[model samples]
Target chain A: MLDKTLIGRESESTLVEVERGAIRRLADAVGDANPVHTDEAAARSAGFASLAAPLTFPGVLAQNERFRHSLDLGTRSLLLGEASIEYGRPIVAGDRLTVKTKVADVQERAGTSGATDVLILETEGRGAEGEFVFRTRETYILRRG
Target chain B: MLLARQLYFEAVKVGDELPPLVKPPVDRSQVARFCGATGDYGPLHVDEPFARNAGFPSVLVPGMLAMGFLGELVTDWLRGARVRRFGARFVKIVWPGDVVTVRGRVADRRFEAGGRYAVDIEVWGENQRGELVVRGAVTAQLFYSGDDETRQRGGQPPLVVTPAEEEERLAKLSRSTAPARPAVGTRPAAAPAKVQPAKPAAVPQKGAPPVPVQAKVPPRPEPKPVAKPAPKAPVKKAPAKKAPAPKSVPKKAAPKTKAGKRR
Candidate 1:
């Protein structure tokens, strides 16, 4: 089981920025053909200052990949289970994002199989405006290695 | 917002493959453009001035770039299908000079769609280092020709494709909209020329900031001799052989042939 003391602990910040070609390429890959994603003119017509990808686009920025090491996965014994995201608004291109992930909960249980610790990580994706665009809840399970 | 209503049940099979994509490597220019378009000007992205003080040798690519890449991987392979749901963990940091590949294999098929097929697939990405960068799993609905009356209307697209029978439809559509891509792969995507400067995406805008002097661009390269049309691999330029930073606009056309065997 993970140390209960590790709960509510935060990891270093990782950031990322949005790129246009990649957005266009992603649009192409999905065959979305959405002008709002590829054509700046279409973007202006729709009211955005420039072409921006969908709200889910924020899922890409690591605050621009500033994260050098991850403390969560490096721990002595753990199993990454699942991850999910709930958004506030769309992440546009040119947006710089910073991610501050924290271990939110820790619980241990012993079943017929064995014993394990379920660790939940809460990551808040912030932009320059300090707006928290996304609040993600990720769960990890730690058992004897 | 509800971007697009995707596939129904009855169309997916266990072995279908989504269209494949090669994500361009991470580099300096890609970082700059991404920051510009998204308006994400966090100093960590482009401010080398501060990034140095904050602790790092240079700028890095965002994890969002990889997420966008995964979204594209699913959308492209469906060839017009919509991605109703998907998710991933940014397993590794992507940087310049690394080759990236994305592939999705149909994993299951469900029939909850009144008659349509709710196709499920697992998407994955890998880098030149043989590292798993992002793993995405998505569910989409496909049209198999007997299912619906609306499939003809581009079937309420994730972004309606106009469903032409041939690639020529898209080729013809390009004639009037986007400028013809000039370099293709012949001009090394990132290889910058010592004397001749290339076009920058920001040039069209008047008040754009002058490109930082420290920005490095790959040297302009000689074309490969292979005669075959370049593979569908994106024009992500190779950054080796040059210490220059990535330029703001290094978009190159598709190469004539596969650039040496991509790992």
Candidate 2:
């Protein structure tokens, strides 16, 4: 069972740089083929410094060390049931971001098989200039062993 | 050739449907490529054995992949429209061999601060079996040909300044460099402004960036381009903070868990 007390726990903010290569890889992975997210000149003409980060890019920041340690989900079967991200602006390559995540709620609900733990986590990302850039909310379902 | 056409708020109707973005059937190689691209090498996404051991029949496609399809659908229609906010909810598992099609409709339209307008689209994805796999909405700021020079900002339009004559435009711009809080999740105006039909002869050349289709509109009286210089100041702020980013890259290079590996 997930520790109920873990609710409301927050993690230390971690800083990450948005890399151009990483943005290109994400564009390729998604099969977007949008030049704005892959080619620098295309991005420049589109009004971005480097390649623009995909809409889902900020979710990767949740994998930071502080969030993992704070969740204390140790070896548990965790499934990413759902995720949603709200962007303040398009995140471009060469931008620095600070990510801080926290467990918003934890609850045990009865399932068809048995009891399951549902943890709601919210991650907020801010640009280096201290402006809110994006926020992602994810729901993780813990497998009942 | 199809991607070169620009979609403007003045031309699109509320019920107009966007062209569907259909993706090839998912496969293992594609999964591996996605993993390498996002740096999310989750065992469940890359290793069949790991996924089978975890009770899944085979490696599963990441939800983000479906989200990407939705992104492509909107941006393709938008052409150069700026995406201010996008949100999605993953509803089902998309496995290899499942072809996904993204569909969208112009849900709402509204006038915003600068001369630009906003288009709200309801977008979603489904598999070949017709199962709804993901649903979301997007708020994008796009330029219209009718916009006067006093408010030439394209994507990031300033907030709606309550008219008090001269105080209307200048006061809002001077108050905050930050964009007005995004009007997310809210429906734009019910009755849209007048929309003009697009010209048929505006087809663009192959592979070249799609030009905004609204370029064919008749020219109007020119006003001072006030919002033109706003974007440059914010672009310079990012590079200053970029110097320390490379130094921290090595520290975050590897996976935190045994099951999660960097490609």
Candidate 3:
């Protein structure tokens, strides 16, 4: 059984520097040919101060070690059920964001195969000035035998 | 194309379909590049042996990658519109050689508090076989062509507009619809200067309800995070204040019972 006590556990804050190259690489890997993601001049022309990260770019920040281990999954087979991100502002290259995560909830529900325990995690990224930038909520299903 | 063409708030309709983006076949190299880019080096996505042990014929594609595809679909269609929210639910595993096609439709649109127009989009990705692999939504804030000048000036539009202008804009928006008809009829026939202050009150009573109804469509996933924290706040405080004494007692008793069972 998944531990309900893991709810509310928080990860130590990690600092992530949003790099221009990283944004370009992710956009390329996803086959998005939007030039604003790769060219600073194009981004500026599009009214952005710098290269704007893709809408799902925060998914990378959520993969840090501290955030991943905040809730111990043990040896359970894990599958991502849902992922959601809400942005307060567009993340741009050269912005340093402080990222922190917390286990929001855990519940067991009947699954297509059998009973499954759902783990909900919420992560927030704040800019250097402590302004909210984005938040991502990920739901993981831990299958039980 | 860099900026392509700008999308305006007034030009979009609720049922408009976004041009679908069909990706080439998923190959190992592409998945590997995605893994390196995102730093999600999960073994299930890269190691064929590990994937077989986990009960899959081949390595599975990362759900985040599928989400990224959907994100591209929305951003490309919206052009320069600012994405306020993007989310997805993984319905089935995607594997190498599967072609994913992303599609979206304009689900709703409304004027937000900041004097910006926002649109809600329903987006999804399906395999070549037409099975849904991921489904999601995107909420983006769009700009009117004239709003560029407002932004360059660094000022927001006034919170309240004159009743006549408000009514005219609403009528223009709903000229083809039914609910807005009644609100248009309520427009005061008196001179604009005379009814300016008094009519402002009536406009909101008629116009405000529908805006909220439209706003409610996109916030379905928000209530869980908003409501979960409230109950947790008290639980956190209670544990800090009085939990240690009781919790320690259980800790002490638990080991004793374990030792008794061992004997």
Candidate 4:
């Protein structure tokens, strides 16, 4: 069973810098041949001041140690059931964001095989000027015997 | 840079389908690159021996990588549209050498209170065997043609569609042979160039902003091309088996679950 008391537990805040190389690497890995992600001139032509990050680039930020440790999952068997992101603004290269995470909810559901614990976590990123950049929500299924 | 035609809110219809993005087979190298990019170095994704020990035939592809593929499909289709929300539910494990195709359709359109126009899109990705790997939805904000910076602020009233009009539209769609739009995966003859630059729009500097840049259409590398035409028929029949009950469970947890049962 999941610790219901951890529902509102928050992680220590951390600073993350959006790097151009990281954006390009993700774009290339996904086979997205978009030049705007690599070329500043092309990005400026489209309207951005610098190279623009892909829509799902914030997934990298969610991997911060501070956020992961907050859950205290501790090497248990788990599977990602669902993942989502809500964007407050378009993130670009050279942007600095302060990120924090928290456990949103926990529930138990019975399946044919057995009962499972559903854990929902939310992480938010704010720009240097204190503007909202993005928020990511993930759902994990912990199977029990 | 060549300018591509922008997808304005006025041009979008209720039932339009996006051009399908068919990716090449998933390979270990690409999976490694993704692991390095996201810092998610799980053994189930990178270690073949460990994956086999975990009951998976081979290393599995990360769900975020598939989500990225779906994101590319939507952004590639809607030239200047800004994605407000994007999400997915993992239905099955995607194995190496499995070709993934991402597709989506416009489910609904509405005008918001802040003079914003938004569209709700239903998107999903499937493997070569016609099994759903990921299913999700996206909400995107768009601009009308000739929408200058001033009109983007709060001024225009909401555009409401009555129930009768909606019913009539659905009825007409059901009666048509091709429905309100063309079928999925059928590329139009006059489709825009794949690498065109995005058109410049009047963007607001603060608050929720417009999509500044658009991705060029995919020029995916085909290392080893499979029989391309074999999967199309199976894709249309995939939705009939939508329950995804036990088949969709991630294989990584199989070994541990059995161990727990033995105890």
Q: Rank the candidates by lDDT, best first.
A: 3, 4, 2, 1
Ranking by TM-score: 3, 4, 2, 1
Question: Each candidate's TM vs. the true structure?
Answer: 0.43, 0.68, 0.73, 0.73
Local accuracy of candidate 3 as per-residue lDDT tens digits, B1-263: 33225676655666566766667667788899999999987777888987667666777788888999898877767766788888776656777776677767666767656456677777766655444556677888776443443453476552433435655876886887766533311222233333121222232233212111001123233222221211111111111111111011111111111110000
**CA error at residue B9 for candidate 4, angstroms:** 0.7
> Regarding lDDT, does 3 or 4 come out ahead?
3
Compose the digit string of candidate 4's lDDT tens values, residues B18-126: 7667776777898999989888776778989866665557787888888988888887776546778887776667777766767676767776655567777777776
DockQ for all models: 0.09, 0.18, 0.30, 0.48
> Per-residue alpha-carbon lDDT of model 1 for A16-51, expressed as tens digits?
666677677555433345567877776654434566
Model 3 docking grade: acceptable
Model 4 CA lDDT for position B152: 46
**Candidate 4: residue B193 Cα off by (Å):** 18
Better of 1 and 2 by TM-score: 2
**Per-residue lDDT of B124 in model 1:** 54
**Chain B global fold similarity (TM-score) for predicted model 2 against the true chain B:** 0.56
Clashes of 4: 0
Q: Residue B41 CA error for candidate 2 (Å)?
A: 3.3
Q: What residue runs in model 1 are displaced by over 4 Å at the alpha carbon?
A: A1-36, A39-55, A58-145, B1-11, B39-44, B47-58, B143-146, B149-263
Worst 10 residues of 3 chain B by lDDT: B254-263
- Model 3 segments beyond 4 Å from truth? B1-4, B147-263
lDDT of 2 by residue, B127-216 (tens): 554445565677787655323212454544443432353244445755775633222212222222111011111212222222210111
How many Å off is the CA of B200 in candidate 3? 47
